[model samples]
Target: MSKMDKKRMKYAAKPGLMAALDIGSSKIACLIAQPFEDGTIEVVGVGHQVSKGMRSGNIVDMTALELGVSATIEAAEQLAKENVRDVVLCTAGGAPESKLIAFDVAIAGHEIGDGDLRRALDPTWLYARQNEDRRIIQTLPVGFSINGTPVRDPRRLYGEKLGVNMHVITQASSAVRNLESCAARCQLDIESHVVAPYAAGLATLVEDEKNLGCICIDMGGGTTSIAVFKEGEVIYTAVIPLGGNHVTNDIARGLSTPVSHAERMKTLYGGCFVTGSDSHETIKVPLIGEDDSEENQVPRATLADIIRSRIDEIFEMIAQNIKDSGVDPNIGRVVLTGGASQLAGVRRCAADILARQVRRGRPAALRGLPEAATGPSFSAAVGLLHYALAERQQTSFTSLYSKEMPSSRFGRIGQWLRDNI
Candidate 1:
């Protein structure tokens, strides 16, 4: 059967709510959305809580992570007044790697159809499968060149050789298994897994920026990741094990304050650039366990200095990674997302360090998205919604296929326990 025919036969018209869960090092967030006929996702519910049991995107404490996940899901369900059995999850913990694989298949002057496309894609899947220790999460067709001519839709065209460029994103197997285990413990099924930076780029980037080439930097609590986009598809990604929490830690250590107080000071008085009055501006910092006292005062300029040093270091690291990855020099713009991007003066710092145009990107406003949720921090969650919408509109040829896995007896035993218990 033709691929389109098979797709139609396999799935029926059962449109319903789409749930997206973003499990990050700093927070656990869930967004419940319903796609309309017009291709827009109306967010019906949103929930987020302070992250626990996860460190640097890895689950350090399973029970603690499960409790956080459950609480976040319950809040979202309460807001939506509906429950979800499955969710599209966003992950940053898996040491994700992106590769562009170029392959060609001989079409023998025949009309391009499902068979031709499938043949072209088979090798890409094979390459992903060869990496036994990795879990393939995203397989995106970057573009197609038919007999040296570029075309977006190659079906029905006649060519001797059809060449395809596919961008494959893979993550560590252990990270994925841990996330899946956490969801299973909560009685939730994972519909699909998306890389965090990829989702953020999808939610916030415009078509023009993507086509023209751009970099998306997602600064979470425990990790800062980058996604490079060219021709409207992600071509490269890298992550650093440092983020806003590190800066907070530095402040806590430097200023002899508590972590919680350091976070508060970072949010309120944090800036990469210092003004003349900063030296004279004294901010009251309360001790973690002590009451308000006169000795707990520090100059705001000192705080800015600490923040600027760390932020500058982050940008320098990002620039070096981009250079090392050999990202296209034509990528002249950098879009910064995630909670850390909200800090004052980050844009200018990134621009000066990365030597690119920098702008803070927030999730695109959609129906029922409150003003509070329309910030850079929520970009990944919102991008999950956008991914679902794009998936819904995809033709059979463009759909992402999950990697093949052998059914394990241990998996069956675990399933039986969950079902029976």
Candidate 2:
């Protein structure tokens, strides 16, 4: 039996409706999309709600988590005026672990093709076996080098042995359970879950940026995720326990204000850098126990200083992670995404602290999504659609072998088509 023959026999098409759920520390967002004719996706419905069960990207309470997910999914489903029955979850809020693992195979001098590639990947199934305290969530390919020559894809590469550079990301089993439990509470099913940072990278990054070198920093409310890419592959990824919400918390503690007020002030007036002008710029701050009209005057410079300090600290940590990941001058620039990346002067602050050119990346270049879905803050959500598309396209051709079929048949036919076209 030939590999191609087996693939044709076992292939199945995926359903059209794709539901994406992004559980960020700041919020729980759900999106339902349908792929369009132009290789783009359109959002049919969307749901978003502030997250409650998670803290710093980890689940703190399952009860609170259940309510949060319920509320968010309800709102999204209501807005779209549709009943959202299930979703494909986005994996961002967790430990954010990424590691490299590989497998080797002896080909017995047999020809290698797409089916062979699928067979080589069979070992990866071992990582799927989960136990207590752990869940394998992502299996991203870094590269495929056959006999020392790096190949973008080894589907048709004839080689004696196949070597794969794989990036595996995992998170706590408890966290996964909490999310699944919450989804169940909200009347939804978990079709699948993808790493949030990787999804965001797909939505915001271009082919060249990923192929050459680029770093993606998703600074949400509770955690900041960093992913490095080179040659269209993820080299490293990490998540920090700090984000915009932490800065807001710092301000609330320092100024003795409520979280709601602090968040309002941060969103409306917060800045990361200050000059002489900010010193004289007095902003009205609400007093905790005052009437509707009661407020106090505070220096904008003070607010900027507080924000800058925390943001700089985060960049320092990111630089350290980049160093640990072996990313140097080769990865020249950084792309900032997520909700917090929308804050004023964040890119400048990132550039100054990381000593790299930082740009606020939005999901601008994709097809079929509305402008509302194209912002840097919605990168992860938009990327989910892309992930679902890629997943649906994946096929296992390992058994594509027949006694009467020859590998040369496919090669000759492919060549003939290429020449004729």
Candidate 3:
């Protein structure tokens, strides 16, 4: 074989199956990825189940939660026809908390390189990581100033002192409990747990949006999560415990229908921003234990208004979060995603409420993705891979073995050491 062919083979050695689990309030999705010999990712397994035992992103019942997780995993395993070992999960619990902490350190008169910045921030991370009842999922660098000038990388620049603004997204203890117990029951291992908004942003937001300024709002079944990025750094994040489920409940109660039927009507006919002439048409919604012909006919505009009311409340809450974080001053655009985001007019409604330029956001991008994942709904699952790849790249660049699984799986030597030593 030629040298290039041999090099390609060497790179293909570590290509293994990576799975994504999006356990939301409304649904649970499992997507397993396999890297082909030609370096393409093929979706070998897919499983999705209606979520249960979760309330607004928190696990309220463990027994039901375990059964649900196991069932989903079993289906995915059956589809993949393999017993997968590791999976990455998404958590919107308690709305992953975001706090900005700044640290100023003297560089001892040395020019700051990537190593220098890392050295200076190591203690800051230790401080944040220590003495907390929470788990830190993402420690994103919002920005840095060397001396008096702002810098993006801030590495290899001369400076007497380096100051950094870091945003830490944290998960609550209950989140850990629900995910851990459920995964244990399912006999699956969680490689990492990431904030839903952050992961979703990774899948949907473009590089320019991150580098410039953009906000990612993930409207899921249980909660609405917001992550703000400036210059490609997440500056703020917050979770609101209201999602599409609330809308379904409202419809169920307001229209006197079952929750299941209400959900069906919502997905098939839900809209946040109603247009003119909505009253000219009517939709047939089945009541509890009723035939189709006996269904209730209601103005489509009324349903849109109901969906909008709850969605408005959710957006108003998120707006306050961004303002409170002092991130809106820098944000220039917005991206919306999640299961609830699939609703008609959601993008438009969000834009009107936030009063900013808005667009539907999907998962940002992946190395080897296909058309199956093109929808806006798959943002979180696709983003998990991006987050892992970014983390891997950072670690691998810092290590002596720069080429060993820098963007995906680690080499055997590294994995062995991580597991054993």
Model 2 Cα lDDT, one tens digit per residue, 269-310: 898976776778987777776785877788898888888899
State each model's C-alpha RMSD to the native: 8.0, 10.8, 8.1
Instruction: Please write out the lDDT profile of model 3 over residues 300-382, one tens digit for every residue.
Output: 88888888899889988887777777665657788988878888988777878788999887764555455555666678888
In the range 1-421, model 1's lDDT, one tens digit per residue, is 6432332233222348898999989999999898888877788888999899888777889988988888888778777877776788986787887777777888899999866676577533344244446655666778899998998778899999898887766677677778878888776778767889988998889989888898999999988999998878788888887899999999898888889989998998888877886768988777666666734778888899999999999999989988888778768599999999988999999988898899889998889987878988899999988877776676424453332321111121111111111
Residue 197, candidate 1: C-alpha displacement in angstroms: 0.7
* Global local distance difference test of model 2: 0.70
Q: Arrange candidates by lDDT, highest first: which order?
A: 1, 2, 3
- Model 3 RMSD, rounded to 1 decimal: 8.1
Model 3 residue 325 lDDT score: 73
Question: Considering lDDT, which of the candidate structures 1 and 3 is the better prediction for this target?
Answer: 1
List candidate 2 segments past 4 Å from native. 1-14, 78-86, 128-131, 290-295, 365-371, 395-421
